[model samples]
Target: MHAHRKTRPPANLGPWQRLLLLWLLGPLLWLQARHVRRITPRMPEPPGQRAGSAGQGSLIRLLVAGDSGAAGVGAPTQEQALCGQLVRRLSRHHRVEWCVLAVNGLDSPGLHQLLLDTPEAAFDVVVLSMGANDATALCAPLQWACWQSRLADLIALRFAPALLMHSAVPPMHACLALPQPLRWFMGRWAQQMNLSLAALLIEKVGRSMHWHPSTTTTAGMAADGFHPSAAGYALWAEGLSQHILAAQIASRHHPDLKPCSAAAIAH
Candidate 1:
């Protein structure tokens, strides 16, 4: 009897294979995007104050900026969204003067442009939530890297936040609203862009920027099934609060360490 051999599929496609696959599936992907857009109701940014102060005594200036999630699209108001949750969580320890500058449909380049137009200001922390829109737009990994690098540079130069927290790109594969093939493709692209972002931040900003992982779930998604529901925002806010608090403790212990400098914290 002849011995049977088991074969495993390759983990990833070659550049040529990817190109060919894209070419073949381009029309279908386009149609899927159109269909999604047509069916999904347009969600406005949740209404709330863009700037507010919380707690008292010593000030911890914070800036939250980026895309729809950061703008609190799914939640009823800003208070139920990322900014409100984050501010509330952080306010437990220090007086928080938080400002949000997020816009729906904004990408990395748009964020950079927004920052360029805003007046220079110092912030103890700047939490950036982005990459989903960039992934949906099919931004190239290299381009993503460039835009991220530029954004980091601008933040460091202008805002000079002691800690720059970059919220991880959400899991597109887990987005229940997105259909197959399109979801698979976007998920892969998002992962690539995230990898590129991590590498770029490590190389350029070092310990200044902390890459945070997303802990969202399908059940925690909003009515649109695209944005984060209130529960999802709470989970995200908890993660950010922990990171900020840990950084604060570390800063207190190391008096000589500069928050935005390479020596501030370990990756």
Candidate 2:
């Protein structure tokens, strides 16, 4: 019997092959970087609240930042967006002035840059909804982590007294589910990235941070099936309310603010 020998592909690669390999590996590595950065939460600034005209002590000035979801892209109108609904709901108790600094496709880095570049007088509460766009960027996990760390540093240095709230990483795979191949890759990537973000939130902010586990309903999906609809914004508002109430009650010892979850509202 003749001995069988396996042949290796090659020690050296052609231009096209090398380019193809780089193309494939680049995204993979980039996505890994996103994962690592997102897993751990960063310590950013407390919201800076401008005194509301209603009376400085009586009002809550909230600042919201993020991508399309935070911008309420899928909603029918701007008034129905996240900031709108949140302001509306929060205003019931205290006068509210919500300043939304967000665009359609901003990720963590974009959000940070936006904050750094944009100048606002003050804010009492700050809410962050991002990371989906970062996943879209396909940045590597470690690189992404570095950015998150830098963001945290920036926040700590700049903002003060104002409360900081971060929404849990949304399920991006749901957005990609229609396209099978893309769905598999995006879903896995999103899962890993969300995990990274969760870890960070725990490590950096601890219990002080709020995480909104999205149970986004398809009916609440935007016409494009990507962004959240009005109903979806409602869900987000509900989640946020829980955190807000929890903190308010904890800080002021207000019995009314004790229960903040949707389940509490449902009852």
TM-scores, each model vs. reference: 0.83, 0.66
Q: For residue 63, what is the lDDT in candidate 2?
A: 62
* Candidate 1 runs further than 4 Å off: 1-18, 203-218, 249-267
Q: What number of clashing residue pairs does each candidate have, in the order they appear?
A: 0, 27
Model 2 residue runs over 4 Å out of place are 1-57, 203-216, 249-267
What is the Å distance of residue 40 in model 2 from its true position? Answer: 31
lDDT scores of the candidates, listed in order: 0.73, 0.55
lDDT of 1 by residue, 1-267 (tens): 001222121134444655676799889988998999899888899887878778865668777889998898888898999989998988888888778888899999999998888766657788888888888887776688788778878987877667788887776755667787887776666666667677776654433443333333455778887888777788778878988888772212224323222121101
On lDDT, the leading prediction is: 1
**On residues 1-267, what C-alpha lDDT tens digit does candidate 2 reach at each position?**
001222111133333543465477666655654654565333222232212222123556566667777777777665677777776677666666556666777778777887677542344566777776776565644455566666656554444324677665565545522343344354455555555555666655422444444344566666555567677787788778667755662112223223112221110
Q: How does residue 179 of candidate 2 score in lDDT?
A: 46
State model 2's lDDT: 0.55
**After superposition on all CA atoms, how large is the RMSD of candidate 2?**
14.2
* lDDT at position 35, candidate 1: 90
